[model samples]
Target: MKRILLRLINFGKKLPLVIKSIKKIYRYGGYTAINIASINYGEILKEKKVLITGGSTGIGLSIAKKSLQVGATVVITGRNDDKLKKAADEIKNPRLKTLKWDISQINQIEEGIKNTKLLLEGDIDILINNAGIVNSITFPNVTEEIWDKIYSINSKGLFFLTQTLCDQWMKEDKVQLKKIINISSQGGFVGATYPYRMTKWDISGLTQGLGIKLAPHGIIVNGVAPGIIATKMQPNYHAQEDNVFCSLNPLKRIAMPTEIAELVVFLMSDAANFIVGQTILCDGGYSIK
Candidate 1:
């Protein structure tokens, strides 16, 4: 009787997660067979030239690794030279290169663009606008300095880089596909704090605006809004709120960096040819909850 009771208890504990998985499969229907973790996208990106800003760590680093795995000539840029160098070393791919870029400095970024164009041999197939910072301040505490610092890197910097790339893509022959992905936050869809939220909202808007403008040229633009991804970049307080944060989403967990990276790789590929002008939320269903 004791053994039987223990078995029942274990089953009961695992039942909810099983049910949720079942529901997810049912909702997505046809996509159930492909295991996201094991699926190999090898060499599909062989001909692509990709650039990812802030690609030294966390989600950006994951993207660089995956893109390199799939055989793309990848360039990763970040403000920290040490981190960028470390990432390149860890990745250890001959096709992967690191660039020192502080996107907040528009003039410097423009110069980097010129060099990057030559590095990629005149055309970059994909650009991932993933560099951003978060500054949390209450309304009473907010200041001009805080706002400027956040926007200079997050919104203003991101926009110019996108513009520079789009201009280059426009000049290229129209036969090949070009993609731009802006990383937004779940805060964009709903109200949250100050400048961080504002920056994300700008990302989504820029994606849509540029999506329309670039669509006619066979260039696709989209945005990704992640919820509480398991990254160091999240606020320090989130560590204490693990259970509380898990409760915010139906998945009952935070998303892994790899999950977001896979989504980015998918978006960058020809697989997402039909997807455009949309900010898809990969927040473990946080928005719905």
Candidate 2:
């Protein structure tokens, strides 16, 4: 009788576990149904066409390299034909192409976009305006020529290039979650010793303004503001002892072009679709300081 009673007790204990298992199965089924209903019937990142300005070197080249790694067909633009060709060769991907044109000239930008379209074979899925110049002059010493040079390249060129791309995308009617990633600088956020900061500030404003205007078209615009990155643009920092410039940042270090490139790649990806109109500070906490 004792053995039978013990067996009954064991059966009773297992009854709750059996009920829990059934409940879990039902919950899983409901989740699966919801997941099925929310499925996206489109490709995520494969075979997308990406265009990047100033892509022959530095941050732009880094972004192109990462984009190509993710199965994207990349077209890079630069003023130097040899540099562009070298960058394309170094990437060593069949999906990579190079175009030579000076972005500072509006006429050159228009012709370059036309040539780029032929190379890309369709509207660009992603456009990265990574070309910019920095004039290391104090306010009092700033020249009109220098100011114009900075504005022409950093502000006017970027604005029109993006406008041309948008016009083409509209004409083609290939509106599949397009993205525009502009490379701004920390100088734009705070006072800097360069007149170029004015141009960068404009870039930040354009990023936000265009994000709103482009949202209805399924396009997102954003900017990445990098601080004290180790690039050709700042060769003086490299020559400094102890790299004291990096110590100014809260992170106490400089950022790599690849690090900034990763953020740009993410901004262009579908993973960051909701991250619009924001200028992400990839400055290793420099802005905080």
Candidate 3:
């Protein structure tokens, strides 16, 4: 029966030719043939080596989990060792590695990347800079220290991380369609009542500029600007008797971390090769209103 099945499979190879001849007789030859050829060249999303910052919880954790589910090797970093250990155990994937590092410390980034690279066994194919901080104080109440912390983590850290990765990619001559997905905020695109918005705006600028600078080297830089995500960060605002932030969006609800994660995965995948220098708004249309 196995031999018979093999013979049948061999005969199936001629089926396309027969169909093409029939199409030719019907005066629609090339269309069907082109469609069949295109099918043969269909692309698949294979496993990648990915590094995500701030992956102990929230959107970062969500992205790490989804990357592992899609057969990628994931390396995650956070400032808290306990949270990193707990998250690693919870993820339960042998391909996932966790590191503890605070991105705000530029001096630590080199060591962080080296450690992450060792776990990945090479340069990362995708880098997701999801580490960020926020404060709820009004603009007038914002202090120099608050601005410095936010910018250091959200903008400066992300920029330097991408710089280090790109340098490594160039050194290794592995700059073919590499991706850098920066996690920004809806506040970057609209007015917000936090000093953190300034950092996110800088992220938007860096993403666009990096997209241009790296495009020649086959690297794509893009961002995901999420709005009102239902994460632990939301409680920092302290403005609501209830979850009033949920209703502030046009969607009338806050997004789950996984929703934003899916978008990050897509942007990092082959599906988004043509999508470069863009900040995808994954806020359930919240920015529109």
Candidate 4:
């Protein structure tokens, strides 16, 4: 009888914790249903034309695939012709085309756009500035070359490309509701610790500035800041079948490239026109911590 009473007391002590767990489950579980509703499987992006930078692999590749699936003609560009060919072959869709262009070469932006137009067969309706490089070197070890290398692609290249495209789109007056979706990093939102994070911060700030400046021009600009994702870039977690080992993340698992692609697709869709100048952080609640 004494043992039974002791057990009852222990259960009572844990009741509050149990209740909190249930509440957390209910909140996140409800988000799944809401997310399902947000996904418009009715071909919301049908007949649109999209251009994705660094589309040879990872998040860019996933976005290209998803855009194609939603009835959009897509042009994916990369610096490597071999990888571009491989990505094209992997997709095997007539509406999908590949271009070889190095975005870091700002001088060749026009030439690259010309070639991209040739493959796209017309001007692109949406531009995805997803091409970027990372330097994991920390502050003490960081060099000027490392900082410039990262910025040349992630910030400078993206800015110039958007400017080039916007110049053309603004003059056309025929195509309405153009969109630019920049792929930033969740690290951009927090204090920076490296060159990569600093570049991302620039991207996030540029996204907001462009959103305001370009709203009157009929172009909507937005961004997606992703946390640690399971990709080749994150070599440690890339090959794991179940990547739930992240201690800093609230969700306890890294996101897949496809997950980021889904959000990109949503941002590109007509349904998200009202959302501008905002970089949505899909970081599994990592920034909150």
Best by TM-score: 4
Residue 215 local lDDT, model 4: 92
In candidate 4, list every pair of residues with a backbone clash: none
lDDT for each residue of candidate 3 in 1-289, tens digit (9 for 90 to 100): 9999999998799889877666544542122111111111122335588899999988899888878777789899988899999998898888999988888888887898889989988767889989988877777798888878787888888888888778877777563678899999888888866778878888888899989888888889999999876577886322222232344666555666777887888888888898888899877577787
Q: What ranking of all candidate models by lDDT puts the best one first?
A: 4, 1, 2, 3
Off by over 4 Å in 1: 1-36, 235-245
C-alpha TM-score for every candidate: 0.83, 0.80, 0.80, 0.85
Candidate 2: stretches off by over 4 Å: 1-44, 238-245
* Candidate 1 minimal-lDDT segment of 10 residues: 27-36
In candidate 1, what are the lDDT values of residues 227-260, reduced to their tens digit? 8776768643234222323556676566667888
What 10-residue stretch in candidate 4 is worst by lDDT? 29-38
lDDT of 2 by residue, 62-160 (tens): 888888777788889888899888887787888899988778899877788878878989767888999887887777898988988988999999999
Q: Highest lDDT, which number?
A: 4
- What ranges in model 3 sit over 4 Å off? 1-45, 236-245
True-structure RMSD, every candidate: 7.1, 15.4, 16.2, 7.7
On lDDT, the stronger of 1 and 4 is: 4
